[model samples]
Target: MLLEDMLNHQTKIPTEWHTSIRKVGQKFDSAAEVRLALQYYSIAKRFEYDFYHNEQRHIRVYCRFKHTHGCPWMLFASPLRNLSIMSIKNFESTHTCGQHGENAGNLRASRKFIASQIQAVLKVRSDLRAVDIKNDMLSNFSIKINYSKAYESMVHATNTGSRVVIDADDRRFRRLFISYNAYIEGFIARCRPLLFLDGTFIKDRYRGILLSATGENPYQPPHRLIVISDADKGIRATIEEFFPDAFHSRCVLHLVENFKKNMKDFGHKTNVATTLDELLQSAAYKFTISE
Candidate 1:
């Protein structure tokens, strides 16, 4: 049987459970504790919160059958003594109706929960497809979600809450630029004044180039400068126009690949190409003209 099955059993509430009015005197440090208490009630009674309000000084939560109107299950909490510490003031754990259907459905499908599930998968494989996400959710949680829901969940999961600036021609995507917040920009200003510019072709249906600008920090990983169009001339002109003071350089691996392609196009023999490739690599590694 599924975990949901075990949780949905309508067993009698344990006498030692914390839902009794006696526990009302207990103090909760945060809203999470209040929610956990409600969740414990949910597990014991096989019902879930249909609505919840988290305010500055109090929290109100209501529980009912999934997709149904009010069914008399509710919980309310308020800050005790301290504004940050919440305590459950009132709760009605018993449901008027029997377990409505076996599946949790919308009860377990909060936006935050959906976003968390999407983010967990993306942390391991960023390239996972929408259909794959739908299938994964169904197989793992027994929840079937549509493509739009899955896509929206991914967007919500990845959004950094920063204003993203995109430049396009007649709404046809031309360039996408992202600016760091003021704090991050200030940190980047103190880093080494070097910019690494690189471009790779996007392998999507409407293929285009992805141009990236990155800068190195003193004791941390490189910081992204911007994302722009892949047109080489446009990229150079933009860089020169906006960031003229920074020294720019191409990625060595990309440059070597271009060199190898040119050599192969010239019909150079395998031994000649190998020798030239080795020499080019050595020259690239040299730090100064004398070396």
Candidate 2:
């Protein structure tokens, strides 16, 4: 009734297929060859493949149906020394049992392949929810993935999409930021030479100061914002280290706050503090440097 049934009875086997065991000694330059071989074998035998040993240089796959009791239908392959091409080293064709069923060796859930597909989806829609992702996978690929696996895939995809660099420790986190090629390119092309630096406190589980640098784009109305963490030295040191030649300016709001705090510490009365704040604001809005 099935291909495996026909093959087990010594019925005629197709010799035209490229994936026949007769093609074993053939050379391959990528892991795709091994996958193709496994797919072809699974289709012929109606059994799934479970990898026992999968690595960069070597691979060992066994029949999932008989893998627990040690089925002899195994496939082994490795790359050639001093060459990139991979060749099959050994293969066992005899199975101790009949075919399992259709959809036996589906590889849509493989870690590497799934991670890559998730990354592609995240690149376009970074806000996609994990539950939605799981639903989409089921609807599109007929692959039912658990919530944890989908969440892990989403996190992996997000990290891959946004290249976040960090310096931290168990006690405290020092610095963290996202830097991508497109952001860098847009900043260089559209933003002005002047940079405004500022920092604010984040009210989160792990409270930390969020330092940001903003620049005005000549062709665009929106400011290009880049978030870079301040090392122990301070925001000035961090900005200077990265943008040594750029013209830096302090935020007027921070300047006013510091001035007000200093005035208050000097025992200034309410009237005096209010007057000083107005004077500071007026000075900040002056049109000429001499004013």
Candidate 3:
């Protein structure tokens, strides 16, 4: 009755699909091709390279492809192979230090460490809302880092401070920064986001632009995305103006807590909070407008 059931009925592989898979195998690295072949009996829809292990490996993955049959079949296909002709070796060796040239390996490791440190700090700061990373935190990390240099590097990378002027008018540097910023913005845009707009009073009694976007999860604090703001408006209005197509939801928990504190009668407040909680918790509330 199920698609898998139907697929299981045929023990032999379809000639067309087998031919297609063989063609797909040629596009990947030999290592990945081997993994693909290993999943011959088990249908593969996708694959990923595993790098954290001592030896580089390619993981054969599966996915459910739904169709009009009212049943889903595991598609043993590779989008990476069809769309891009990246050698399986490239995928497997990208994470290894020695696979690239010796100089490249050193640079790669340094850059990787710097990037990892920045991400770690960002994550911690986001969680605490303000992280005062002192000697204790530094010691715990087990790395001999000059915090000042590390901070400076991060600030430069984040574009919050002056960039190292290798060449002031270099088109290549401009292009690289532009591309990097675009990539970071794209990453943030795809995730659950929170946009906040405010003004920070500066010298000479003038206020500066203070627009920031962040990705928030109830399970964790959010990554900050700072951008210059142009106006004073309600958070909702600013969010709507900037990202009209984006999804937004008010913090109902905060709202309920505020309501409880304002109301004098505990019993009545509790009832109201319970009702509000039920209404918001319902799956229907998100898709429908509250009357």
Candidate 2 residue lDDT tens string, 114-216: 4666677777887899798888766654455666566656655655443444565763557766555455566678775445555789999888778765655
- Runs in model 1 deviating more than 4 A are 1-29, 65-67, 97-101, 105-250, 289-291
Considering summed lDDT, which 10 consecutive residues are worst modelled in model 2? 9-18
Would you list the C-alpha lDDT of every candidate in the order shown? Answer: 0.60, 0.62, 0.37
Worst ten in a row by lDDT for model 3:
93-102
- Candidate achieving the largest TM-score: 1
By lDDT, the better pick of 1 and 2 is 2
TM per model? 0.47, 0.45, 0.24
* Runs in model 2 lying further than 4 Å from the true structure: 1-116, 119-127, 130-161, 166-176, 179-182, 204-206, 219-233
lDDT comparing candidate 1 with the true structure = 0.60
C-alpha positional error of residue 96 in candidate 3 after TM-score superposition, expressed in Å? 50
| Candidate order by decreasing TM-score | 1, 2, 3
The CA lDDT at 257 in model 1 is 68
Writing each residue's lDDT as its tens digit, candidate 1 over 1-291 gives 354455444343343332432345567778776665554445343455655656755777675552475467666788776478877788665555555444543355544456766787799898988688777766655555765556556655776333345565764667665544443465455655455667779998978877665655563446445333333677678787887654445556666767777898999987788788888888989999988
